[model samples]
Target: MTRTESLANRLQEVLLNGRWIANTNYKHQLEDITWEQAIKKVGSLNTIAALTYHVNYYLAGILNVFRGGELEIRDRYSFDLPPICSKEDWDNLVDEFLTNSEAFVLEVSKLPDHKLDMPFVDEKYGTYLRNLEGVIEHCYYHLGQISFLKKLIFA
Candidate 1:
């Protein structure tokens, strides 16, 4: 498969549904979690809800760039999730995350292979391949945190 297709698959694996790497994807981990559980504090780490919004924040920002918009995400605001006061709030966040994840994957898959080497927004940010891989890696990193937090919450 082309590199873009492979990267898109990897992105899907971490964010949507593929068990080849972490053995758990974001969808599987967050689907059954209650709003209370999602906001539960597990020591100093970020809440599941925060992390979910965090990753989705980046996905959305980059996805916008993919659609020819400017990059507008800021790291300081990544975890600035509005309070999830009810089950409906948590569900909306998850639904938004899943929708953005799918859109991100679709954008990546649609890229021409040559675009992978092109600068992503700016040369300092590195190539499209680098940014795409970074997103996958970033998701897995937070996914691990969410997994561990789940265990801690239930323990």
Candidate 2:
């Protein structure tokens, strides 16, 4: 399959996909939560909304890098969306993050096999793949954290 398709599959299957995984110890699989509930605290007071925003922000930054722009590592899990946070904000940063990630993946998939060998200095982590593959890897990494956080928050 194409590289972009693979990346898209990863995103849909995990990060932005619906339907949580049942029979799993991970609380991330806990489904049917609204934004309010996501940010609600039952015991530990962990907000899925916060995790979602952080993941989306990081993904957006990486995608921007792939599109030949600067990669800016934004905030982590917090109350605000970091760098840009407002009720009047775009209100679609998460969606935009996913969209931009997929677009970046598409561009990378079309690259010639040799192009992946090129070198680009990473802003956050220097000396990396300098390709879309790196971006995909980074997204999945954060996704794992989001999932794990869900477990802790729910547990």
- Candidate 2 whole-model C-alpha lDDT, 0 to 1: 0.50
User: lDDT (CA) for every model shown?
Assistant: 0.93, 0.50
Q: Please, what are the lDDT tens digits per residue for candidate 1 over residues 27-116?
A: 999988999999998778899999999999999999899999999999989989999999999999999999999999999999999999
Model 1 stretches astray by more than 4 angstroms: none
Model 2 scores a TM of 0.55
Q: Indicate the residue-level lDDT of 108 in model 2.
A: 51
lDDT of 1 at 6: 92
Query: Model 2, residue 40: what's the lDDT?
Result: 55
> 11, model 2: CA deviation in Å?
4.9
User: Per-residue alpha-carbon lDDT of model 2 for 11-50, expressed as tens digits?
Assistant: 4545445343322211233243444445555556435566
